[model samples]
Target: MRRSKTILLSLSAAVFITGCSIKPEPLLPKDIKSSVKKDLQLLSNIVKPITKAITLEEAIDRAVNNNIRNRVQKMESALAYKQIDMVYYDMLPSLAANAGYSVRDNYAASASTSFTNGQPDQISGTPSYSVSQDKERTTTDVSFNWNILDFGLSYVRAKQQSDKYLMAKENEKKVTQNIIQEVRRTYYQTVSADALLKRIVPMKDEVKDALVQSRKVKLQRVSSPMEALSYQRELLEVLRSLQSLERNLMNAKLELSELMGLKPGTKFELSEKVRKNYDLPEIKMALEDMEKVALENRPEVLESRYKERISSKETTTAILKMLPGINLNAGINYNDSDYLLNNDWASYGASVSWNLINIFKGNTYNKIAKTQIELAKEQKLAVSMAVLSQVHLSIVNFKQAKKEYELSKEYLDVAEEIFNLTEVGNDLNMNSRLVFIKEKLNYILSTLRHSSSYANVQNSYGRIFASLGTYSDMKKEEVKAKKVEKKLVKKIMPAVEKKEMKSPTFKTYGIATSNLNVRAEASLDSEVKYVLEKNKKVEILKTISIKNDVWSKIEDGYVSSTFLEIQTTEVK
Candidate 1:
């Protein structure tokens, strides 16, 4: 029985030690690198080879959620919220506990004796100096302090913090606006690249066919050798153009993927097709009204306004520095010479303090503060001017892009008609091969130009909306406005749903280890389960149940799964 108890105790100890010794999993280099490389390659393939079938709104949503810079700004904004909360309670009283112990080798006690009228006066006993002695002291104190008043200085400081918080909020808005513009621009570029590729590939095939025909005709003595050579040169040129377009397409894909914060080399197929027609909204408002809107809605303008308020508060704080600071303090202290029950002392007193003589020495700081106020005013003006200038530029570009899109559409139609006529003439032997080729080239150029012009106009519209600080508002308004007009435009488009592949699942295991190198036999299974592949990327997600921690009583937020692709095998 004693032996069995000993064995049981040993086993229990071993289990406890193993359970407590468990460490987090270390990073696996080979696996991580391989996974990252695979993810990047997959991204590259998608963007470079796949057709895009994602909408602009979807792209923007992805960018906002995934873009690194945008995410950083979002985090900063969140941190600022906490800081705002902290500053809001700055006026509250603070309490602190302190304890200390000290040992001294030398201690002295002294008293002075005074003689009145040539006679020595003594009370209780004669005053005498004591020999050095060791002393030990220990003290514990609880203190509380509150700033009752500071001539509006605390108020000014709080206001400054509030303004800073507001500025941070506006900065977040600015980042969001910038992100929307970037996503829209990149989406347009991707579409343009796709359109150009479509045109160039067909043109290349046509040129190649023409070259082959020319070679056959020359060999049969139906055409001159020089003509055949010219056709071959044209084919080579067309091939070079195709190569350039392919390179451009690849670059556009890479840029779009980067903007969307996909792993480098990720593939994307644009879901939105290029549309040629855009109904330009009439600008009925005067420039002043536009400026007013910008001032009212622009995040940068709001930031600048907040900065001005911050500057005003800073100036007030600096001026307050010139005033003398006064503080009232009173505290009770207890002292005892012996550790036991004798020689105890207690005292309490109030004290006042003032620093009145530094005024002459620190006038320079006050002067600098005044100068800063002026500088801040100038900066505010500069920001306002820049905002107005940008708004003007955006308006001008919007008009220009619209006009170019219109012209390109008309030119494309004309070019298409001419090319058709030339093809028919060639069929009847009434047109030369060179004329036919030139007409074909003209059609290709027209199509490319029209596509590019349309993209440019769309991007310009996005910019204008961004500059007007109306992108988000416009997005909301568009949804509302389209509902009433849905019947009229119902035939213009059809809704398409995207299909996604099923994600893979993996099981997690918990292992116990007593030492770093040796595993223990005792292990407990955890009931927690987490989805690892939510985003289709290789990021790990760990979830713990509320019952596992001290804050188990409080409801925790839902843990989403994160997915990472490990490898891709080519299927035969």
Candidate 2:
């Protein structure tokens, strides 16, 4: 029975522990649904979609205007400024006004015994006086108090808050620079992916057609089973490779959409038309100049300096706490009572108070302040070191990326020339079908590599700019001149009108409410060809039910019906 009771107790304890355990907030299907709903509402209001090619400048502006992360940083900076205001109020004199009612249970009396005779042993007379005090009374008072020591402490606190407010601005600048860097990187990736996809998409269709013809030819011939199977396998492998590349291209587009704060799967074209022999920015400044620029302008370095100032002011505040306090107070009071004292009075007073124990603890306070100052200085030094290292590394990486991109271009050009030669030979019946396929694959692969390298070059430049804590038009020659003239406005840009494409005839159109897949079939496990961004327009041919979920068929593919907002239904 004892054993059974112990088991029961253990079970009870387990239950209690489980009940008290903390759970992470609801971050699953419900949160996802909520976010989809919000995106749908936001996109529905956007009448124009990006149909024309988007310039890098335009893309960056859109991201800065729409990104929630930048807005969050701006709000944080505003909160810091409000904190400075609150600290400033602390330096003002404290004023208080109060009124009260009091009741007494009895009258008050006083008596005095006096010896009128010059003899020490004799008491001449005894006199007494009595006065009836009111049973109830009302009193009111207004007072003002000012402590010089506290005011000095508050001044230091306000100064620290001001420095912290500057720190917030620096932090905002840092976040903005990072955002712009991301825009540059993702923009290049999107353009590269799009370029590669356009080239491979037609190639994929041609290869699929060729695969069908080859299988037909194999079946018509009385060839060895091994030979036929090998031919079929080769074609399937080619198809598989192309499919994988297509998927990667689709994913790259989705990522770009996300970075721009657009609905996932949104389709937009980039302005960079040529894939090869593209002109990119050149790094003109030397390493010394880069180091100097980074040290002076990098947000992290500036923020560290501000933090050191704030810490020094905080140390002053801590020392002030250990000092003696001197205060002045003034008040006027009014009372209504049936007593012989004055009913109204005005008074003023001054005081000086010190904690005697604090005198003995002065050394400890001084040590703490000293330690904090040293810590702040060390932190500042560490940040400076990190910034300098980042500048040097970024420059090296940029140069390396440029070299790699140039090499990739050479490889792509050679592949293109070889593919062209193979195509001509195949047309003249001098080259076998297998040789043509292999050359085509090589060309496609080289194209993809070239695109990736191009993106890397852009990303490297983005990193360089980020390390320097600035963003500017890379195509422009004189960045330093523009930086000096431009105001440091971290404000959001105004929304611009995006060009919209017209719909095809008799097509039922809908907007995607979430990032959704365009699948080969109306099934959950169907192969996904494209990912439609939220707010992207799709032509819906019909709707079909796949188990519990409804799906809409478009010209090229099918998508989930739950997140599709049919335009005609809404219009009606």
Candidate 3:
């Protein structure tokens, strides 16, 4: 019987535990439906059984929509939005529902049998006995509270949350812009590298042909062994350069793919070539115009502005701390000696509270908030200066790069003409091998310079657009420059603008005149100045300062018009 009773007690205990335990509800199917659908779509896109080349824009779109980092930013923005909602809701009355049950058993003597005051005389003559009984009880309650008046704390908190949401939204935009820029930059770099590899392939073939011809001449006793060895060394050098270029090209492509947030080991083929065919924008306005654009469009500048606004709100909130807070609480409670609804009882009441003594503590936060506003102001000034400098530098680089590209094209044409004449002279046995090789080297150097100059122009444009936060607009403006006619008085140049000018007679000077010595001279307008310096035996003259110092001309003839500071020192 005792064993049976023990099993029965264990069963009762298990039931009681199970009844008191809370079970969490399963996630609703609709909760994750959107996420599941998105994942499936991404999987389908990536696993599609076709090999189609994706454009840079398409890649960037896919990355922004599906990339982990971007998705995280989006989620953070959403969370901030929810937080703002929560803060607003804090100002409203809250309602809550609660229910519970309990059971208990007590072993004690009944009070009815122990109390016999009138029968004391009979009780004294006979022994008194009391019967024991068991008692059981259970109860449950529900309650809620809401702040009635908090001295604008709720409103200030909501405003702060709203600012946070705005900041997060701006942060999301910043991340997206950064991702797009990275994708575009890496895509262009890969395309450029590929173009360079294509250019090097023919050069490598030419070196191989020259090596073979030199070896044949050596066997025929027409060329010395030393000459053949020189050809071989030249071929080896060409091959090494080719290999390095190829490796770099591959690395660039891989990097681009990675930036697009592609899976590891995925291959990407650029659909377009990195040709230097884009026309420069007609930027007639001064550097100040570009700086304005940067200030308005740059994400960092906008973010800083938002931060300053947030700090202002925070200062107001801190000052409002001097006021006392008042809260109201009201709730309904029920109690019962049994778990039956009929035996239960209910009660409700309201109360208010405040912290009047804490107003003296508000001064500390107010002072801190004032300090924060000053810090924000300083930060804004620093960012404005930095943005101005960046815009100025980018403009100067664009001008100088355009010039170098034009010069490189002219140099390439001259080198090609010299190489053609040298080839003819070599065939007629009038040109020595050394002379032919020198001409070949010049031709190769010119080609390299042309490629480098083209790359520089493209990079400068990229930087300019990047600073303006509009690099994505380049997709619509790619075009090649037109060829111009060459005349005695007006040289119409290819890849450069044509202008009419007087042709001066060429005269040799024994020594360059000191009048050509360009020094940093302030113009009649003190804001404008000119500077000159000699480098690598070449004299370079530059306008060091404009009315507003829009651009700086470097010794290399490259002009950097962006607002970036140029380090200058007194010439010894």
Candidate 4:
């Protein structure tokens, strides 16, 4: 009764302490200010400086290396792998060691009576009392326990978690593919805007001035009211289009900056060659091969396969849980007691336990396991169908993008001729500029359309690559660049590089830029083995960087990777 009162009082004290401690606590303004300050500092320090104009290859590398989304996916995969370790530990036997000290106001006492023929007799000395325990004592217990049924269930669960880690990796791959697609689309748009913004800005200024003057002319009645109104209306339409186009171009710059994981309003440049010209990506792989590889590398399909494995293992777990549990326990114990004969002891035993209630629920558990397996299978089938549809749609869209780009190119050619003819006739002046502004607007509009069409073609091309799930080329360049100083960089033209001491599993190819030199070694001074004329296809063995320049090892010699396209290839 005394011990029960102590325990109740302790519980009440704990409740009182908890009640005293509890209160609504939110971030004060000062705390929020500090947090924001730290975050801003981290953002500024995290990104590498844009040392030079970024190429398409370099931009993709930055997105992969510095983008928070990619970093989070990688960390999540690492976390899942660590969780597998946690699950494996669950299969291990539990061991516990506990030592306790206690004090009491009175000793543990007991008295006994003996009876013979229904008559009770007390021992000599009247008030009989015996004490076996002291008021203060210490105890130590070390125990080991293992349950066979629980171990089996934990082992099955560990297997499922192992597959979950692999699924995380597959999801990471999917995120990387999407990032690459986004990089390609934005990189070109940024480049085109950089080149055309100069023309756009001047043209916009002139139109704004023209609109202001025309409004003044309308107010002064310098011309017929209808003519002046019509002129002002034309100027307004031109100004609106110019402003809209400029806004879009500016938006493209910001989007590219963000995609490359740079700070807002960060200044950077793109390579001169790419800024001045559009390098169309080419995929020479057969459609059937493309489809075949898509099945092999697509993250959705791989993740689905892992889910099927997990579901199968879960059924095993269900069955393991229904069996009888056999618990094995062993312990060593020690205690200090003045009246005890032995102060230390060792014990070991096993106990088998069965839950009779679970026997009746066996059928229900089996049905649930079976249903989980079916769901996994159905989901796998759905993912496969979706992947196939994406690959086919990407190809069709790519072709249409190319056709549209070609048509835009033709229109640009005609517009260029008209602009040149007007310039040759000296038909442009402050007064006539507004009269010819429509002609100039058509020409500039054609230029923007041509640039946009090509960017779309590039975007569609990258989408097909992303859908097919090929990032080997980009990954190799990032690694190769890191070998120089251990960061994602491709200051030299980025090309796919892999070690090839022996024949590789698949063939990779590249095209020559103008006249390419195949050197005896990866250096400018090395003897030229042969020259590859412009646009000749070369089978790439591997690529490596010496200093900052990159070189691709062809069948017999090395060629500079600066002029070669890396991301698109025939994977056979």
Candidate 5:
């Protein structure tokens, strides 16, 4: 009894010391950490403004790397790998170690006691108090268990998880291809709209001025009423068309900004000259051959095939679940109860168990698994057919777009010629100013149409690549290098060109990583006196370190160094 008390006191004191040394549980749930981190990131993005002019290649890179949908797909692929790890671990035997203590409400006692040497130890037939086994006991156990059926099921699950990971990768590729397609299409449209607007704006202003002048002449009776009204109506029609084009221009720019992960209304210039000669390259593959390649490479088809494989595995898993399983168990136990004959013991055994009831019910599960496998196969076939159709339709559309673009070029050329002739006639007093203006409007409209047609042709080409499931293979550097080589060969020029430019002399410069607040003071908590746009270059006068972060003093104010990157540039 004294030894038992000593052990109990020692254990209690150790537990008390350990409990005091350990940190308390978190006040908030552990899951909130991810949410908090994500929220901070979101806040940072919201405060940042995009200030760089993104190139085509840069835009595609950003879309693939930073777009939320693509990020989610990447996370899903990571999650699938984690799941495979979990299921694989489940296939291993389970091992557990545990310790426990228990005490009765009242001390365990017996109703009978040893007889004493008196006439009668009390009432002979009456019960007497007696000591019993220890009322409090402590137990320590270590156990290992393995069930064959569980391990088999876990193996199947692990295989399915691996397939899911592959499917996720394929899905991400599909998404990337789709995003690239959208980026290319929207970029072309945005650039075309910008070019069209440049032409439309001046023409629109001229038409407006003409209408105003014509109204004045009509009011003075200097111009014929019918002629004035007809000219005015024509100008109105041109203005309406210009207004519609302007609306489309805004929408296209907005969409391009969104795809490039820039804020809406962000403005930048495009290299329109590169788009002037986007003709379809020669196609040597036959339609049937293209279809075969698409079937073999398309992500959707591949994903469907993986799904079918997973379904088949699931069927095997279900069958295994219904089979009798052999379970092997081993344990070591320690007990501190006085009543126990053996205080420490080790046990090892194996047993086989079968759920007899599942024999009747498992048929339902088997049918379900079989049906799922069939469904997966059917879906795969459907995807294959759809992919073939997409390939054929894309080819037809590419051909049509090419034809239309070529015809538009011819139309634009004719319109330009007519406009030039009208100008000559007006100079010779053979045509009215109104006729010149009208012909000029026609030429501009033709130019716009041609530009739009060119964009359509490019889009059709992109669609063809997308249909082939091979758009991702198109490298931007190759295309850019080709364009550069052509330009260099065609237009050799001197290195020093005449230009009116300003060069700022600075000790050093820093590039802003976000829309940093340029405060009058160095502290971030200070008032935001001015906001520096993200990715903008600022001349740094000096830098000072506070804690682990640095603050840069610019010409205007101070900004955090954490958001600035030093840059070197040459002054001509």
Candidate 6:
């Protein structure tokens, strides 16, 4: 009893000490400053170095390849895929090995007494005492348990996981499309800035000179006070507009830098020549066809379909839970004891257990599961409707952008002609130099407008494709995780065969572990088409997950996934 009290007191003291150690502590200012400095330095190092001028195509590539948000989505899709592998383990039978060692200060002793009728015969009873086990001993056991109900549940869960992985891939596609759109918009704006920066700088000096002359004219009364004040007002208005444009032009480069995942204030040059149509073949499709395409390819629509599958599986899982369970258990156990006839033995047994009370709740649970499935279907339809709306809206925006581009082009031509005539001294109200400066500024404004309007037109055109989900086929024909093994993973899931993944399905880096054979299909029995050299880099196009094995369709052909490592992103 004394020893027990001492042990309890020791445990209480230890618990108090641990509790004290866990008190909340705030970071010091110096520590936070050091962390910030370290992270900024690391951020500067990871960005790929730029060479020469960056074109629109290169800008898109940089954003897709290095944008932190884009990379995160790729990693997320990969994580979801890996989870499918983990859930498969849960479906397997429970195999466990246990080992134990025990010691005591005294032996475990039991006494047996002789009895008469239903009670001990105190007058003639004899009692015996025995110690059957050693004071110190070791025990070990290995067990295997399989439950039919649990297996069914795990199978359903795996199906859900497969759908989830596909959904994540679809989301990644949506994010890539967004990145491309953003890069295109920023690239054009930056090109406009680069083209106008030099011209705008010299014009500022002319405007300042004109403003000073107008102020002097007003003070000396060389002209009417009203007319001189009006001239100064014109000069001031032009300067304000020019300054605003300059500020906007200056920030365009910064926005592009951040989008491409480069450090802030990183200086880089852009190609002055804008990619008018971005090298993409003209998008020509009827509204009806576009709607059809959007419905077929939009990530939101696909994600909804995947969600519906998850819900249907949930219904099946619920049913499995309500049914009876049959468990089969087998184990082998051993004991180290001096007084035992058999120190090792095996056990086998089967059990059927049903909660009769669950029958009362079965109908309600089934209804709830079915209702959830209906909800998922409704959500899918809603997403499909939204996708169609975006398609129509993108078309309208494209038309408006086209008209604006034409109008800006006309304005630029007229402004340039007027500036030329004034520079030759055609009556610019007698002050041809100042008037020429004003005309020069107008021409510059028109040029800037032309660039901005054209950029909008390109963005709107891309939006049409983006809304249709065809932007998935981007530069290099590879937007991050280009939809993955949809053509195959779909057949492997969906409770049936469905949608196919269109090319190019993404290419990620992987290495062959051996002289791996590339098969015609995701099976061993399929004909082996080619062999890969060990340790060679393989361009993985599609990844398929089958029962216990994984296969990747690479440039050569389908190879065992176990030998290939998929790197979602790499820092160089």
Winner on TM-score between 1 and 4 is 4
lDDT of 2 by residue, 1-572 (tens): 57767988999999999988968786799889999999898864433467788877777777776677887899999999999999998999999999999755555665545555764443336655656567687989999999999899888888888898999999998887878778877777777677667667676776787777666666787566577677668777988998898887777667666656776666678875434555666777788888888888888889888877776675677677778999999999988875747888999999999998887777787787778788888988999999999988988898899899889889976775555444322321112566777777887788678878877877887788788776653435323322221333221100001011122222356799899999998888899998999899977666555445667778889888778776532222
Q: Which consecutive 10 residues in model 1 have the weakest lDDT in total?
A: 492-501
User: Runs in model 3 with CA error above 4 Å?
Assistant: 1-72, 107-136, 149-152, 202-228, 260-278, 319-323, 338-346, 352-357, 422-449, 469-572
lDDT of 5 by residue, 360-424 (tens): 76888899999999999999999999999999999999899989989987887577556544432
Task: Give lDDT tens digits, candidate 6, residues 1-572.
Answer: 57867988999999999988996789999999999999998888877898878877778878988899999999999999999999998899999999999977678987866698999755425556689999899999999999988899898898899999999999999999999899888887888887777667667776787788778778888889888877778788888888988998998888899889999988888864532222222445688988998999999999999999899887787677789999999999999899989999999999999987777777877888899999999999999989999999998998888888878777765664454334322222425445766777777777778879878877787788899898745353333312223233211111101112222222356687778888989899999998888898876665555655667767767888777644532223
Candidate number that wins on lDDT, 4 or 5: 4
Q: What is candidate 4's lDDT per residue for 1-572, written digit by digit as tens?
A: 78879998999999999999999999899999999999988888788888887877888889989888899999999999999999999999999999999987777888878898898886667667889889999999999999999999898888889999999999998998888888878887886787667677777777787778777777887778888777778878988888888888888879888877888978888873222134455667798888888888889999999999888876677677679999999999999987788899999999999997787787788888888889999998898889889989998998999888889878876775454333222223334556557667787777778878878987887777677777775345334432123343222101101112212223456687689988999999999988888888887766565655768788889988877754323236
Model 1, 1-572: lDDT tens per residue?
Answer: 57767988999999999999999997799999999999777655432233456777778877777777887898888887787677667655555556667765446555557789998777556557654323777665555555444635667777788788788888888988888887777787787777566655656676677667667777897657776677677666766766776787767778877777787755558875555454544445587887878878888878877877776666566666666654533333333446445333333333444555646635776677677778777887888888888889988998998899889989976775555444322321212555766666666667667777867766776676677776776566434432122233211101111011111222222121111111111112333333223322222122222322211110122221111122322223
Top TM-score hit: 4
Ranking of all candidate structures by their TM-score, best first: 4, 6, 5, 2, 1, 3
Local distance difference test scores for all models? 0.60, 0.73, 0.59, 0.76, 0.74, 0.77
Q: Give the higher-TM-score candidate: 1 or 3.
A: 1
RMSD of each: 26.7, 19.5, 18.3, 18.4, 21.2, 27.5
Candidate 1 residue spans exceeding 4 A from truth: 1-53, 85-94, 102-137, 145-154, 205-229, 261-271, 275-278, 284-286, 330-357, 361-366, 427-438, 477-572
lDDT accuracy of residue 335 in candidate 2? 87
Q: Model 3, residue 52: what's the lDDT?
A: 75
Model 1 error, position 262 (Å): 4.2
Report lDDT (Cα) of residue 411, candidate 4: 86
Off by over 4 Å in 2: 1-52, 100-138, 217-221, 265-267, 338-341, 427-431, 472-572
Error of 5 at 503 (Å): 38
Give the CA lDDT, 0 to 100, for residue 467 in model 2.
Answer: 86
lDDT of 2 at 138: 90
Q: Which is better, 2 or 3, measured by lDDT?
A: 2
Give the higher-TM-score candidate: 3 or 5.
5
